[model samples]
Target: MASLLPFQDLNCFPNPHTAISNATDPINVGPTPSSRTCFPTLVPKLEPLDDLFEPQEQEQALGNIISTPNPENASANACAGIPQGVPMEDHVYSEFNRISQMFWAAFPDNVQQSGDDNVSNSDSRAIVPVPKENTQVSSVVVATRKRSSQRVKELVRVGDIRIEDERHHRAVVRRTRMVYDSLRILTPMEEKKSSDDSAKRKRPRGDTRAAAMLRYRGMWLNRDKRIVGAIPGIHVGDLFLYRMELLVVGLHCQTQAGIDYLPASMSPNKEPIATSVIVSGGYEDDIDDGDVIIYTGHGGQDAKHSKQVAHQKLEGGNLALERSMQYGVEVRVIRGIKHEGSASSSNKVYVYDGLYRIAACWFELGKSGFGVYKYKLLRIDGQEKLGSAILKHARLLRVDPIFSDSTSCFSLDISLNKENTPVRLFNDIDADDGPLHFEYLTRTSFPHFVFHQSGSATGCECVESCTDGCFCALKNGNEFPYNRNGILLRGKPVVFECGPFCRCPPHCQNRVTQKGMKVRLEVFRSRETATGWGVRSLDVIHAGAFICEYTGVVLTTGQAQILTMNGDSMVYPNRFPDRWAEWGDLSQIYPNYMRPSYPSIPPLDFALDVSTMRNVACYIRRSAAPNVFVQFVLYDHNNLMFPHLMLFAMETIPPLRELSLDYGVADDCTGKLLICN
Candidate 1:
């Protein structure tokens, strides 16, 4: 009988009697080899869910049907009964790719090395292929012994481990593309092998050839020079892509492209003024200010034009007696053309680089004290007026104001134009004491091509001489009172009323024994606008006295080096010039671009309006709302801090102008705000 408790092992003892054995017979070793199997009466099983059962009666006989010695064999048995559609290669590749991904994630930029001989083995490691077809990781690849890319041409198939390569075959793709482009380079017949390729011959030259070869930039240009085709979003290690866009193709004409959409050269992907603005005031908007340049119909009859007009205009036409730089005469394109064996006149220009050229048209000061002058202008190039230039078909117009009041007593620019115009655009602070050599580029004002360079044999007798769109200088010794074009015309930059009357710096010319005098100012600039930031936020300045200065230091190499040297080797006093001291390193370096005030001295703190100062800063002090007026005494014969700053004792007012540093024409002013900020 057994108690109702867990059973114990049965007691089995070795045989009580011991037996001896002779050498002839074998005997069992020290302990008996066969062990005893113990048996005990077991208790009755209970159902696991029974309420009456204790924890010991939990397990029941029907709870298990498991077979021993079968962990993996179960899968084999299961598969034997059912079907698994997954391809063996796909399964292996999937597993390997997952492992590779996890590996890289674990060691992003770190390399693993075992010992002292540490070297990278990542390149040699096999890459597992990623699926290409949308077939749910069932992509099939045929692996041959042929290896010709950045991929391994092998496969491994073990129980659960597998590996393959996934490379795009860039070299092969590039080679095929080169072959296609080469076909286009050959003449029409040279490319013929079979009649199948003949249909492509009718395709336009650069336009159709690109798409067939999968060259996107050229294709985009063919479709339209604006859109770029879709590309992989990642930009890592794409130097070859740049080569394809730039070197292989000659499509740099676009204003902007790539990530930032900046004009290829001039724009560096930053916000800048797009269009210029100009405001000409008249009561009921009737006055045109008689501007030398005006759009076909000005654009800024609204915003930004009113404040400037408010300052200069009153109910009557007369401006304030304290009007700053008002009533000036002309604009000078300093590099005037020399008439071929005739009296000098006729304001004509031509185009080569597609940019029109104008000569030095001077401004007479009439003893108006040099301070500051502001101007409004319109830039227009009409479709009917432009002939064959790139701008011929573009609707181009801009407006802006100009301010030029500098210290140099005078400035002259005579660089010639690509299209033999009378002048290029401008020369700098050098005096216009020397003679100029000018030439003609635009067709004569009349329809005849018997241009000034060759001159018309019939003069005014010619049917269309000086009639269509040009100004005629009496070249080839034609006649007196040379003919001219007017800037007020409906075309691209036409000149008006040019003669010997427009002299610059307006010395004592007020007595006026006037000979064809039309007053204006000539502009030379390296910037589009001299960006200004000061005590006040921007104010709507009337044309009275809006002023600012060039903040660049123009230094020669020697002088720059001296300034840049360590404190131990420096020569000049650290006490900076008043205008530029606060600006510090932001100040312009010399030889960079600005008129006068070079390294022999600090970059002038302020860039005066050329129209007003007319080289007055040679003696004036720097001012935001500057009160005092200055004059140019003379040159620094011995290069030193100017001998004496000459303050002008004058009770006169004059209008003047200056140039901006950007490539914008110096006189466009609508975009020209006095950035009082």
Candidate 2:
């Protein structure tokens, strides 16, 4: 036997492979028994994936090997292989497998071990075959059959193994085969970073105002509900009250600047739907922001019934609805609650959904004022069920006496058109069905209540006037926010976000901007220099398109710094992130109200004008050209855009020399030219 141990003792330990100066390199033990003692060497190598042996077992006896099925007698070869200390002509292959034992542990499933063997051709065997699992392959490396030997090189990720070094390719294979009967690749191990260490990294401190204000460095709301632009240099998640109307809550928008923007870059198709709402129960209010028992249609306007109840509850007690006369529908209400501080203290919340087996619990809600909730229409198989649901608990005021106390409601607010939902309304739900489905939304600011009465079918089309500031949205059989201009109550604007006559334009993006309105924007700045040259061009021209807009902002190279999450401070009035640059050409001007910083980088008011009536021609970019005469027009009128004077295009861009306007605006045409071409 190859020496029981490498040293003098009987214990099996490695000889401390001296050749492994760099752990990445494979150790090569020569084909000499005296030099390679089988004293159970430390395992570092793994089996090559493409070996002659079966993926999980040694098909033959201890002394034998496995091979691919031959063209003839496939079944014969399955049992014909030799075994047991049987030294065959393929000794080189046997020796190769012997070397593989030193490094097999790296493979997870290569655990089949061989017992002592004798030099025999055939012997008894114990084998269990297991299907091979594919290696956790790298995205870059694809497997191919031609490179059979190369599989061994991929088996090792030892500290010393240099992936690109081809010298150990053969030895790596020999050692791998000797160790494992099975193998598989693992996913790349990710090095985790501790939160403390991340926090310790140095960063460019946030801005000066960030330290002073503590709250203004980002978008926030004030007490009055208006928006206060961010204060320049604060941390994320900090909440601060802005100019009264709006509050600013820090989000990770700046921190996650480079995050994945597309969420559903991959998905499948959608399914169709039918009617959504199953009108369960409803009641009308007797009082109308007043104290009078009027006719409640649910009770069919009983004067004697109404007067008896109004007199009974005059002292304040309870309004209970437990019988079928109160509501005529079935539902599964998972939650319910009673109205607090009601005129009647004992008003019990009756939930009818659970009384009848219909659908799952989607939502249940009720506030002191208007009770609200939502429901998702579940599609089982391909059928859409209109299960009428009712509020287990709600407290809505209907002016006072009649139906004010028992009103429960909800709305559907979604971008339904984009979702391709089918909605339909029906007269009798049990009758022949149509294609329309009902979708509802809620605009809570309006404070209106919505009732899902037993016979109310919705129209097929979903609501469309949904944009910024609009309260309502519709989706597949469900509703969203309760908007001001949404659902109708007694035929009036819910809360009147925009005055009736001031309705927003159909294509407008905000609730504020409407048709025929000119919003004025103003800025406060101190005057600097009186004037600057307009343009110097190589050729003169008559009036046509004079590049009318002004280029007001210019950045510098040292100032053209790119900001990263680290080493950079945040900006305040946080607008115009796209306009930031180190050094470049001219950029356009935004209003002072739109400026992010308190004191903005100076605006160029200087322009060329000959008449000296203090005529201000907008600043155009600067340049040096021979024939391009840049002229400034003078006007006696106060308006800067109209009633102008002189004209010129003074800047000339030579052949290959690229050009751009350095600073301001162009000359205006006053209709009468002061100088002829």
Candidate 3:
């Protein structure tokens, strides 16, 4: 019988097999007892992606194995049978899986022994999966299939001229997001330094002022080109949390100035024209009437932005607004309003309200009894609904749920009052036919086999909330993983959140994902093609904001397989694509800079059974270009073997937009049918 015990060397392992050394060559070992062809203890190195290599070069790279002589060996036979045009990584993983299956099949006694142990300990309680020794190797081998099949389709369709404008806009938007993500990291560091010296100055700097100035000095902006109409890649409903973000994306140029304009030397008519303006209700005399905005031009305002300090003049930005109105040029209008959910009163959310034309300009007496330049800006026609208006409406709906059609809602609070915010269930397409009968689950339910031995717990000892240098924060590279605004600073392989063992209160900043449902969400019928039921936020969800956790009954791979064979659908969390690289592409621009780390976890041989009981996340469908992404988080449980599957918004999702995830190939392309793009 083949030995299943651990061994230091491949040769020591009781298996007569050949070891594959590299991608092209296969080393042969003498045949032994069973007909099964066992592989080396170590897995073969994955091949480079074809996109990184030219076609001719890629063919040349694979030529040695395809054209080389094949001898009477299992490895040689497998290498020779590799079909042309197939992805190199796909073949490697396929062979690796075959070897693993054969190896396990050869040891029937060990398999039965492990199966019996799991069966004897099985219970209905939620518990961690048993930690396996070779899980890391299997996880790494499976993790390479990160991009969705839709991404492959997109790559093929990129050359089409019909979508050239769209392609260009997507590239610009991607780069802009990258710049913004990078700035999020840099701004906090700069702010910390500024805060240390804040006492020395009479007027302390705003949140991102110092950082914006530094980025300007470094010229770390998307582009210097200024344009008049709608800026490429920026959508009307796009939201920003900082003024620095607007600067990085080239939507605005000034670090402190509200009005951004092109000088007369750059304008076609040799006259200064306003390009964009921010209306933060800074002037008491300003009126915001949805489509029409009475904007207050820069100057004559005190440092506090409350009242005018001097008489207004028609020059600089004031003159630019007048010229724009006279020349019939459009101006981008952004609205800055206080984030209702933020604890800090200074925190504001900026919304791009689309192109607007200056209709009239005049000097008006402000509320402070002083003259101030005022400009009436009218929103352009045929644009999407205003994002700010949607947010205001959503706020009202939350206060009085009855304001909406109560009959359309199948269930008002699907969480059964478990979550702090109520999750509504609505079905307008059909006659209030709610989802099939399923018990509501707020958290993951693990099997009873998870070993729970009493051990000394390790955690932070913060009195109120965790701070930098705490145990939990230290585990995350000695820095708080979340910003003061509760946004994740950067995506990592794994996020360590404060658990019950920690002395900090439940509201600790370190426990971000643990806080259930920060945004109001609802289950709605999707009108989009091929989409059935979908989840959407009732309020604006910022990028990196924790939406909800994938909660359901967790089962071992063995249990899941039996259930699958018995016609039960299962969700393999490990098989979800790793698209965290989309968060930022700074490495493409700066060679030394590293891309945002994708959440990497070991291949968890477990599946979530959501048929009987599941959360709202189950309703979220899959998409190639998804607005949400799965993140591996550990907080309530101590098992690295099984982390909670948490979903976070990959980008700013406008209210009522369907939430989708990039569900890469199910089983990581291990010959299983593709579940989603």
Candidate 4:
């Protein structure tokens, strides 16, 4: 009942049975014909390859065939028909047989023969029916084949994913584990103890007893013995306990320490103690003492020397003496005695002879042909016995019971005789006769109406001495210029005093210049010299002593220039008498006293015109050998616009000596010595 077709008309190759039957003679198959193929009656219409096996069924059949050991069974499984319950179609069977034959032909070496007759024909067919709900079943065969091919290609390329030799990796892992284990081995208590030991090693260790002693200004205090170690670098101005014993420690030169030759074994709690063996010879390259008071001198030089002698060079020692004269360097006078007996019996004693400041030092050739080092020290005032008393008396003299009011006049002492006899006023002198048309300002009062004070209204309220905290003293480095003897310290500037608003008492040490003139001075007319006026001192004036001030009208440069052009001279015009015709011009007589002319005028901001009415300062004559010079000063005021012109003694002047000042001239006025008969 089925249509028959030629063997060439089939869609696939011949069956495996046919191929095995004619093994010797191979039949070459061609393309399928259009006409139907002739075959046995049991054979039905052959269906298409897709109709015979779905994609899912084909994938399963292929997996089973590859896994099966028998070649006949694998071929049968790959070409299996429909599900078990469904009737088999002749066309489906024929198509399956063709495909199996072709698969076996393609891989003939993989095929195997099996002799199992008990295996059912249906069981041999491994194909199963695909579920109707599985819509993606068509792509299953392609996806599986692709995945298999990819796996094969990857294995061929990479060989294996895991590392082949893991010995190095294992070693690294073992070392890391050992490090972690070592870190965790220490306990918290052990770690803390180790840290504490490290801190102990870093801390400094010293004698416990010495560490317990109090330290002040670099000196260690031994409270039990009431003694202090005088380590190096101790300063002169520094203050220490009044009654403590000083143990002088030696420097680079010597290790031996003893007090001047007196007994050092005994303790003295009453008076302050000191040590001998003054250290010397430590000079740095810069030749400066680092601004400290300490300085070194020639070791073998005699301690006793005159005040004027300053410079000396050493025979064999460091050149530390070269810088001893540096200004402001403090000097310590250590007095001691040296012992001559054995070390056990011998004792040295030392004492402090007050403090002194270095004034000068130098190197000079000595009698021994070698250079000797010399230094000159000025005794500090408050430290010396006599100096301290003089300062106390000076402060007492400054107090005024009469002028209790703030605006009251200052006290003035006028004397006629050398014994300092008081007089009310001068007889011949007239205020109108002076060149400047201004009233003279005596020590009695200031010209308060013309110039206003410039500093803060609040004044210092120091009781006796002005400390460093005092407003007036703080402005001037906490130092009062005038000494106990009422003498101004050399090389100091104009100092200010506490103002009326100050709370300090009238007798406060800070009120030196404000107390007015202390020495006796007089203004006199000279008939012999053409310079009609001159000032003289009745009492002896020491060097660096304060003198009277030069007071006049304070005018600006513009105002002064106008007055000069209008024939108003700033200074008194020189008048030479006929008897002094041989002296030529007044400028030649006093060559140092040259005044500014019209052509080359001086550039001064403020000029004090003493031409019309002036003080006794205008009468002070010019001399080649002068003893005083003018200094700029500010009292309780701070107005720098018009500072006061004050005069101070440059050198010592004896009684009845005519006071004079150098006019700063270029020519030598000392050349012509005149003898008055």
Candidate 5:
């Protein structure tokens, strides 16, 4: 028979088998109980325990065991009346002890219960009633308790069980994972600085004078109407008045002593000692005091000296330099006044030297090895002296207008023949044809040539023969290219015109090219010679007479090379054959411009392409014995950088004679002529 006492009371027995054997002995029944008392007293009160098998259950179960006088005896008496053949509850008691050991091991400290007062120091225990009929049920209960105990041990080992609230524990774990996942490579401070810098750069700055000047720095007069230059109805004096302040605004030229000479005014105490001397050592050999001096806004580089002398280019300040390049454009020259006595009495001021005229201009390398623009200038006589002399000794002569109509294709002030010969276009091609497709560039597109105002020398009011005393005639060595019959000289390379600044009447003899076309011409098909079109004279043209000009887009050498390689047929080489040798060595005395070896391609050379958007000159065909020849002329002398192409009659021609030009033959590296059939 087994004890009917609760499982906790089994702790008092050394062995459940011993107790069962003693209960069967009649001597062990000293305090034998009646049937009702035995059952009720041996069975302890059954109270429901919490889900966790709370410490309170262990305390009450232990109290029942301690209240008994001899727990082992009571257990023996209690089981004395039980049925025989019931296996002793040793396994159940062993399992109960094992579960208790596991619980204590899982929670070595104190177990935390749910609700307000969570902590408890007492050990937890589980109690289950044994069924007298079945040992299998008890074995099942023991297995279930073992599994629950193992689960508790695993929970504690992995640290899933927390002493704090379960919700708070979970929240802390989630926060840790989030922080690890959201980590960034860059620190917070670095990211904020980068964002702030990006925002600052995106903000716009106001329109200021410095900003405006920088904006309009590289634009030309034709592109920007606001620019002051040789524009129609505008004078050179007006530019000086509007832009005098900007002349020295960005001047970078300075002396070795840190003294700048570009300013219109300077402090008397810091006056430069070498005011009259040229900064460049070799400049004095090529230039004289009266020889037009071009003032540069920036200093020139030593490496650029050869290029400047060869090209006759001078670099200077932007506004002043461009304005000074205009034909007959006059600019006042000033020098700092040196004070020998007390500095108080002597004030810094610019002493006006005289006015000078722009003769020629081009781009050249500067001291810093960067590309810079340069200008050539010629001194102009005072207006008062020249103006009075012209009025007294000059005589007005009958002169033809320089242009027939402003709306004509060849827009100039020249007069055309009144023969009424209708001009014709043969094999007419549209501008959008294959390989010739290009945008039409108007006169305004030629910004390098166009000027906002005329700056021609107005002081020269010569009405008749321009004498050597006349500054305008003196500029050309007192020899005009054209005669009274409008016949040009045979060997002239360029022709200068009397600009708007000249005091001479519109009929001045110096203004020949500006007088426009004078012969009747026609464009006709020439399929026989493989030439698309050709031009012929409608009327008889004598030798040395001015013909139409070959006009086209000006392109750099690199651009021209690209066009030629791409099979462009309208490209024409614009080279100065007579000056070619001089170009190789500009300084005859020094010979510094000559390089040790020639480059594969000249970087500064330019060309003209008339394949698309061409003028009537495109009709001219090539021939061995051509009647016309091409000549480079500075028709609009205001822009020295651009040279106009003019056609001259090489020989006398009858009416309807086909006008032709001898396009120079191409030669190979061996100097052998390579004729293209």
Candidate 6:
């Protein structure tokens, strides 16, 4: 499980499951002055009792620092110092109540009521004071609540996983994306802050990524159990931006080790077996040819000096591969490739290439002239197209769409010359026409709408472009919404962009979202029937790259509600998920950092009627974890109530990957398009 806790040694907590043995002795209750045989004390410390509390309740309950009686006096009754009239259970309960009161009083404003109703009602009850004789007794309860709370959350999150959901693929994929999105948002801010603080020592690169993974490690899926076959909900061609992401998804349980295996103790035959392997060109002797890989065994390298020092032995992963071959077991194969356009610190992207089996195994000398073990892994047949192959085809498509071999595109440009880059329409799934006929609209259609809030009429005076001190930049907390590379620095409640009335040029840096679509996208029928028609990019869309604006005819909430009652799809601005909040959350890294909050905008009563006149965003699918997010921008118009809904990439999206959004609606909630207020 070393992969499960990737940052354990790098300032993160120890192994997540390692119990804190320094905890004080448990409360031993002597038989209640009636029985001859003393009842064995069932201590909470010895049992896995943290799972007894609800996820939310554990956070509020575990925050309180409570002390327990010393282990030396464990043989005596807990109520030995209490008055004779009080029962043992009542006396112990009263003592806890008194301590809790003291804890809450220490930080009165920080108190959060427990989720359990019975626990919350105790605040109204009278608290019995500690006896004068017991005052000298030291508090012995250890600060193990942090570890318990983490375990509690892990169980709670795993319990929520549905094995039978049709959207299982989307569910797991989204969870991975959400965690990375938060990481992406924090890293840039951390780097910028470090650069400005010359007096402070600079943090090593990629520390934020490690910190984020550790902070939310409990919420990771597929870690509770290891499956030998294909991981349910994880599909071939799914791309991960980092190696840890593979751990998060349980694709490969090793953080750095190329091979992950089930130990002899875990295997049914009592023989270690290999489960998965990552081919990243780490060893020069290893060979990879599309469907087949000549994998290298781990060990024999001196990591401290970064070279081979000893000959390899068949004891660990090397032996496991031999056993897997004898058992005819399938192993998951993932290919890691260099990401030339990576925006994040990690320069490599990992692709899940489905399952493989060990065809043969032997020992050999390596390129470094040291003896090593080698295994031949041949890809199993009848799986989806290899992810690496799809990437190569995508590169060719971007270069010349017409020359690509596979027959899918029926129409070259669905926008009909509206957008700068043509949005291709493909339908190899079945004989279905494009989405219901709709007028091709590039901008939001507002009929004589005028809204003038405070500071809405003002415009920046930058002649060529806007920078740090420009009015537009100052409105965004003295930082431009995007960097010189046009990447978003952070998510804000509302981003002010250079408007038409501004003196800046049309191509100003501040007008990123205002520009028409740049990358090529396609509206195609998804192979997964549940998702229906979805949008996928034909080009690599980097993190924070402008995708498209949610454009259509605008309508009042009342009008939209009436139409919705008549069975019409209406996009509500408030219904869009507050995904940006997590994207900008700094509490994980800086507990005291009060994240910048912009002045609240007036209530948005407008809704876009994309049922008719619409853009490519109308086809994007809704997911709990979405790779694209809507950013509210005010540029085309002065109306604060009707801000343009611009969509941007939440991460570096690979080609042919379906784009999704967290449509901030409950699972039971019915149909509605995205909205962000």
- lDDT tens string, model 5, 340-401? 21011122112223344444433333333333333344545442222111211211100211
Cα lDDT tens digits for candidate 1, 3-36: 1121121122112121111111211111132433
State TM-scores per candidate. 0.14, 0.12, 0.66, 0.31, 0.31, 0.63
Best by TM-score: 3
Q: Give the TM-score of candidate 1.
A: 0.14
- lDDT on C-alpha atoms for all candidate structures: 0.20, 0.18, 0.58, 0.33, 0.33, 0.59
Off by over 4 Å in 1: 1-202, 211-419, 427-677
Q: How many backbone clashes does candidate 5 have?
A: 25
- Give the better candidate number (4 or 5) by lDDT: 5
Show where candidate 2 strays beyond 4 Å: 1-677
Candidate 2 residue-wise lDDT, 1-677, digit = tens: 11011112212222224212222311111122233233331111121111112322322111112222232333321222222243444322233233233221222122233455221111111111111131111101110111222111111111223333222342332122111100100000011112355566432211111111112111111111100111112211111111101111111111101110101111000000010111112212221111111111111122322211211110000111111101111111211123221111223121111122112111111111111111111122221121111111111111221142212111111213311221111121123211112122111011011122211232222134444333321211122111232111111101112222223344322122112111111111112212211221111111111212121112222331442123322111112121112011111111132212211222222221212111112222222111122212111111112211112111112111111232221233211212100
Question: Model 3 compared with the native: what TM-score?
Answer: 0.66
lDDT of 3 at 547: 92
Instruction: Quote model 5's TM-score.
Output: 0.31
| Candidate 6 residue-wise lDDT, 57-126, digit = tens | 3233222111122323322232122333445454322322222222211112222345431121222211
Model 6 TM-score (2 dp): 0.63
